[model samples]
Target: MTVGYILGYDPDTLREIVDPEQCAERLDEIGEQRSLPALLERVWLLKVLGRLDEALVLAEQAVRVARMGGTRKDLLRARVLHATILQNRGAFAAAIQELTTCAEEAEGQNWPLLAAFAYQHRGKVSYDAEDFVTARTDFKRALFLRQEGGAPEDQLESTLLAVDAAERRSRSSIAS
Candidate 1:
């Protein structure tokens, strides 16, 4: 939320769409760097670049490494990224399952921001699957969690947009 640098890049600007050339440049810069942050950044880059298979492989590795050497939060973050790659790959059920667990764990740990992220991504997966009602519910929860967690304005606005989209879809589906 602080718009910090990851591998010399601001992740917020590149979240949804990464410039392929920039991504390639970063990958080149990250050459032979197998650190956790480097691996995670690589996973994000590969994912946005439509290299889902490679992303998944790296994501799984990130999870393993986090489990072995990182904090609990690190493991959860790695799992979330892994689940996101699954969501991107059309594995809706698996993604939802993983996100559900991640959300619960984050909530149990009183990590509202992380829970919001899980819920938001889960809602996106539901929306992609045409489960508009579930999407709306999840998005609303994410919005609430974001607000409660005092997230950045842009993050709250993003969740609001998602909630609005899901609500519209839900209404249209009901009308049909």
Candidate 2:
């Protein structure tokens, strides 16, 4: 669990790079001998490979380990990742609830980056449910937080898309 190597991989890199099964299996083996961060990485790799159920189990273990270790940051990350898995599985409402809790926790901890991520995820959940107004509000909040946190330009594109979608929904509502 080298922090530098872990932090070096941006979201685009994570989304683009597909590890071979042999690599993932090796990671899993190494993870079995390590701490929460290694386990979390194994779960994340599995999730990227579309093994949602397996990732969910590993995520649960991560949450449990984080809790036992009294590592709030790790717990929060595990919760968010698990919520993302749930969202991918079509459990929108549950994902929203988890993200909402995560957002509140981030706010309490003064972690604007985490709050922005949680709000962004919450907005996606709202968009999936066709609640454009709520989605727009969440997106706006996420955008503001991201800007304050100095997030990358590509990250800002999600806010742009959310705003565009919300405006389209608003126009259609007006026309109808």
Candidate 3:
């Protein structure tokens, strides 16, 4: 799988019911690579496979590696992924706090794509926390950033879907 696929927060993928056997197969295919990118990929895969403990450890290592040697973009990306592991582990406050910092850094750097990625994930974390209003706001920001940055069709579509989902949920919550 591509790095984008591994690192991205794809609602479609999350919505699907993963098979344990297939997860095991995918884990085996990943084997024992030790590169920074490989660690990040492993973090993503482990998170997807419901191995949050392992994912968190790898995610921390990835962040440390990126901070020490990788480029600014790499460090931001690693931090975003690390925050996602926190989100998956139900650390909503911590995840939101980190993502907010990541988003601000990306915006200050004028990296629209990175900003969009951070906002998009922050939106997901907010959604999981049942903060639909905040989720909608963050998703809309992500959509605008993606559009301005000319993100890929899939990324744009994903943001669009997230916005729609958040809007619907927000409305339902208000009606209740």
> Residue 111 of candidate 1: its Cα lDDT?
98
True-vs-predicted CA distance for residue 112, candidate 2, Å: 0.5
Give all candidate RMSDs, comma-separated.
4.2, 5.0, 2.8
- Between 2 and 3, whose TM-score is larger? 3
Error of 3 at 109 (Å): 0.4
Instruction: Give the poorly placed runs of model 3, Cα more than 4 Å off.
Output: 1-23
| Full candidate order by TM-score, most accurate first | 3, 1, 2
lDDT of 1 at 118: 93
Between candidates 1 and 2, name the one with more favorable TM-score: 1
Model 3 RMSD in angstroms: 2.8
lDDT of 2 at 8: 23
Candidate number of the best TM-score: 3
| TM-score, every prediction | 0.88, 0.74, 0.89
Cα lDDT for residue 83, candidate 1: 92
Whose lDDT is higher: candidate 2's or candidate 3's? 3
Candidate 2 minimal-lDDT segment of 10 residues: 4-13
